[model samples]
Target: MTRIGFRLALAYRSNIIMTCVALVAQVFLLRMIWTSVYGSRPAAAGLTLDALLAYLTLANLQAFVTHTIVSRIIHDRIRTGMVFFDLARPVGYLRQMAGFQAGNTLGGLLLLAPVIPVVLLVGSITVPVNGAGYVITLVLGYVIAVQLALLISLIGFWTMEIGAVSLLYRLVSQFFAGTMVPLAFFPGFLGVVAEILPFKYMGYVPAAVYVGHISDISGPVVVELAWIAGLWGLLVLTWSRAHRRVVIQGG
Candidate 1:
């Protein structure tokens, strides 16, 4: 399944190209916006222009790499009555989805290889303060993202259409996840809200760690692990109920 997903992603040349183009465009556009905001200033919000740009660049790339279509795929399969075949397989359905998403993420990472250099050149992005910490937190962030996506996909079990729900999730997650702006700029209650939410682990935490906004990764890592554990428990319970629903409906 992983290989199949990787091959499918690679085969979709137009998608890869368009995604890269869009990412590049977004990087430059964001640079312009931030430059204007920082006019004649070296830093604001405790982050230098370069560091802030780096954070945005890495956050955008991470968001793109972690993107998942699992919800849409699950919804379509359920609607077409094809999901039961997956349930009957020896392998667990969630495991299979995770494997495919992993492959898809790898494909996205590959697609970003060239684009990364372009953005780095244009943005003068700073190197990660703690390379090892960045790597560890980023991987943890990916795991958290996958689990969150799976939880969303599980909604397909009850809903006939998940498009609206998925869209709402994307919008909310993107905003709170710090893909559009760093949580540092969220302001008062909004900042407090973002800090408490799991969404920050998806984009903000890892990027902040990379750019040195998060000097100590220990706290964020612990929070991420806690969220991962809690989310997994929720996922297990949800999947159990979803499985029973599928069985009853199929009967």
Candidate 2:
């Protein structure tokens, strides 16, 4: 195996196990929160006990699956001059990184495979998703998540602060994408804003669509496609510029 492949495999396997541990812990904590919240006033007009539990489970799973903090990849490489090796290689640097990310995602999915069934069995939870929707939205969100991470990593060519930047991005994404909590809990104005952004499609919209909370899937699908197109276009532009910048800067 290539050094990059092996390194990614090792990291991905370790991180995914860690991710499952974290996910289980978070789910239990959320269950406690759900108990407290439902203890006082059980149901809202739209949200229910089942819906609430459903929301918590989906939120945890999607957040765990889709979250990527790889901006550090480039920052680490660049600071250590490991990026020089990437630049000298015959293959396109973007292709190399894409392969690495794919392997990472594969390992992540692998880790989740066992943990997910165990969580459901122990917690007595059934997902809001089915076979076909699961396959489609899972793939879509996975691609979106990876592309987003890549776009952020590309920022390293200009900024060394990608670590801090990615932290900030995750924080904001929680609020905007409704990953911190579902947008259904948000007040009217904030909910409106969340609906408009592509962030929701990445986490809430897809999950909800698969789970059947989202009645109108067509609109979100269109918007998601637009965002994917925009992101891919941006990725191409940024990759080209980053490559050119590195060649010219001689670092």
lDDT by residue for model 2 (48-149), tens: 666666666766777776766455666798888898888888988777776776755566666688898766653346655454655566567667777788
Q: Report, for every candidate in turn, its global Cα lDDT versus the true structure.
A: 0.85, 0.71
> Residue 53 of candidate 2: its Cα lDDT?
65
TM-scores, all candidates, are 0.96, 0.87
For residues 137-217, could you state the per-residue lDDT of candidate 1 as single tens digits? 888888988999899989888886789999998888888989879999889999999988888888998898888888899
- Tell me, by TM-score, which candidate is best: 1
lDDT of 2 at 119: 63
Candidate 2, number of clashes: 0
lDDT of 1 at 52: 89
Candidate 2 regions exceeding 4 Å error are 1-7, 11-15, 40-42, 127-130
Best by lDDT: 1
